[model samples]
Target: MLSTIVLAFQRWDGLSARRFTGLDNFAFLVKDPTFWQSLENTVVLFLMSTVPTLVLALILAVMLQSAVRFTNVYRIAYFIPNVTSLVAMAIFFSSIFSTNFGLVNAALRSLGIPQQDWLGQPWGIKIAISTMIVWQWVGYNTLIYLAGLQAIPKDQYEAAKVDGAGVVRTFFSITLPQLRPVVLFTVIMSTIGGLQTFTEPQVMVGNSGGTGQSGMTVVLFFYRAAFLDNDYGYAAAIALSIFALVLLFTAINWRIFRGRSEDR
Candidate 1:
């Protein structure tokens, strides 16, 4: 990390002698439109994937918790994607969302809808990447939420039942409140994962971030700068910036969840 910080201020192509450039790299970064674009795409993808994943995971966890048979089987099935190789999954999703002769477009056509190019448009690219992220992580998050649900004391549910609480009421009042810490854990993990996303977009859309650069993410941007452009200094700067951004966001998450816990 220290090496990266020092490198951020120096210009060095991997093969050339190092020259100190001070903040020149950062100065250029401020004027670079692509940097801003990549940041926006990262946040957009984060929101697009994390929100749906969490909501779906919670719903699935609740349902799984209520199941009386084959609980382990259901849990294992949901978790399979999380352990699967991401590059392979990304390639699979690429085919699924392919512009023509893809399952998604074929299904849409069967419903009398025109086939939309999934990778040829900006929003489509972002959507495809986000969908891949959600698919890969939702099951992992489901298992996390399931673990939290299982850890809840039975007395709480018994008490809620004794009070004539409906399922929804009990869930919102007892289950959710008790699971706050677990939710916080998942939120922070998801945020970090979202910010550092690389493999999915790289595999699905390539290092250039696909058409219109819509799938560009912060980490991918840094990777391109370092490996492709060979601008080690600028790449180091981007990497440090990403680290700071992740730290800032993680602190924000801690404060928000901690504040809520205090209030309750």
Candidate 2:
């Protein structure tokens, strides 16, 4: 972190002599339209990815918590994406969402549905990347939720059942309230990961972040500034901005959850 802060003041291409540029890099970032675009895209992707992920993960956790055949197999299957190589998975998804002659387009065309350029268009690219994010994280979040589920005394469910509470009623009144701490952790973690998202976008869309720069996440923006543009100072500034953004969001989420916990 200190190294990044120091680098933020020095204009040094990796191979060139360092020139102290002070706040110029930061000033330039302020006016850089692409940087702002990337920031916006990052936030959009965060919302697109994280919300459905938590919902699906919670549902999966609840389903798996009930006794089921091949439960362990189901758990491992869902978790494989979380443990797989992100670059490889990104490449795989790129093929799946490929504009022409790809499986997705082929299937769509077979059904007489128009094939959209998944990675070529702005919104499509964001959706594709967000899909990858959800797939990668859902299982991990599921496990965390499952742990929280286990911690809830079995008698809570028994009591609810004795009171003639339905599954839906019990889930909202007992399950979610008890899972607050786990939800808080997942939310903050998802926020940080979403803001720092890089690999899937970079791998699927290339360094330029595809058409309209929709795949340009904040971390990807930092990578291009540092490596492709050889603007270390600017990259450092972006890095700091990313850090600040994460910190701010995490603090906000913490306060919201903490307040709820206190109220409860």
Q: Candidate 2, residues 1-264: lDDT per residue as tens digits? A: 899999999999899798998899999999999999999999999999999999999999999999569988888888899999999999998998998867889999999999999988999999899989999999999989999999999999999999999999999999999999899999999998888999999999998889999888889999988888898888999999999999999999999999988988
Question: How many clashing pairs does model 1 include?
Answer: 0
Which residue segments of model 2 deviate by more than 4 Å?
none
lDDT, candidate 1, 98-117, per-residue tens: 98878999999999999999
True lDDT of residue 4, candidate 2: 91
Steric clashes per prediction: 0, 0
C-alpha RMSD of candidate 2: 1.2
Instruction: Report how far residue 249 has shifted in candidate 2, in Å.
Output: 1.1
Candidate 1: C-alpha lDDT:
0.94
Q: All candidates: CA RMSD in angstroms?
A: 0.8, 1.2
